[model samples]
Target: MTGWDISPAGVQSVVSNVRDAADAMNSGITLYGKSVEGAMTSAGTLSFGTDGVGGDAAGLVALALAKFVEGTERDMAFLPLRASNSANGAVEATNAYISGSLEQAWNAQRQATRAPDVTAFLEAARKKAGEGR
Candidate 1:
């Protein structure tokens, strides 16, 4: 027969690591946003002349930078929430594992299979961190 062994302490450790990662990511994102807040506008104003090719080039550059920043922000927005949800799920599974009951095991499996509510987790984290963003 094949079986699995799980340590609650190990799972708890993973949960702590994940939460720490989420917090770090949140801090980094906040810092990055602040640092580049007006970069797009600054870049756009680097035009050389009213009808010069440099103006068009500067506009294109600004647009590209804006898009890049937007994409980066969008891609990173949910990462912290994902990490938090994963940590929460790990804790739930660890509890179920410790209970050693068939029903709890099934519940854990269900929880694992469900999609994480990242938006809610993000909101909670932001609130906990005393951040309006």
Candidate 2:
């Protein structure tokens, strides 16, 4: 039999660290968003040249920049949510362990390992029914 050991303090420390990282990442994201907003505002009136070709090139550049910003925002939006979920899961699991519920659940699963084989039981029943028929 294998033994399991868990430390509540260790789990708490991990949770704290994850939360701190999430906070830092969120702050960085907010700052980046502000910077991008400022840059976009400044670029709004930018002109490449009075010629049609230059105007088209400038429009293409602006469109590409906008797409890049949108993609980056979409990709980074979930970082904080994922971190929060991870920390919350660790806390919940640690609480279950401290309450002895985790052990009880493991024991229950171990006991259930001796469950009857349903396929064999079904085959036996089928054979008996066929014999009677």
Top candidate on lDDT is 1
CA lDDT, every model vs. true structure = 0.70, 0.67
lDDT of 2 by residue, 1-133 (tens): 1365768899899889999999999899889878766666556544566784555233444566778886775456656766776677667656766777886545544443343444555467569989999
Per-residue lDDT tens digits of candidate 1, residues 13-111? 888888888999989988877667567556665557677865544466667877888667545776775676667776776677677764675576567
Which residue pairs come into collision in candidate 1? Answer: none
Off by over 4 Å in 1: 44-62, 113-133
RMSD versus native structure for model 1: 5.8
RMSD of each: 5.8, 18.6
Q: What is the lDDT of residue 21 in candidate 2?
A: 99
Ten-residue region with minimum lDDT total, candidate 1? 53-62
lDDT value, residue 110 of candidate 2: 49
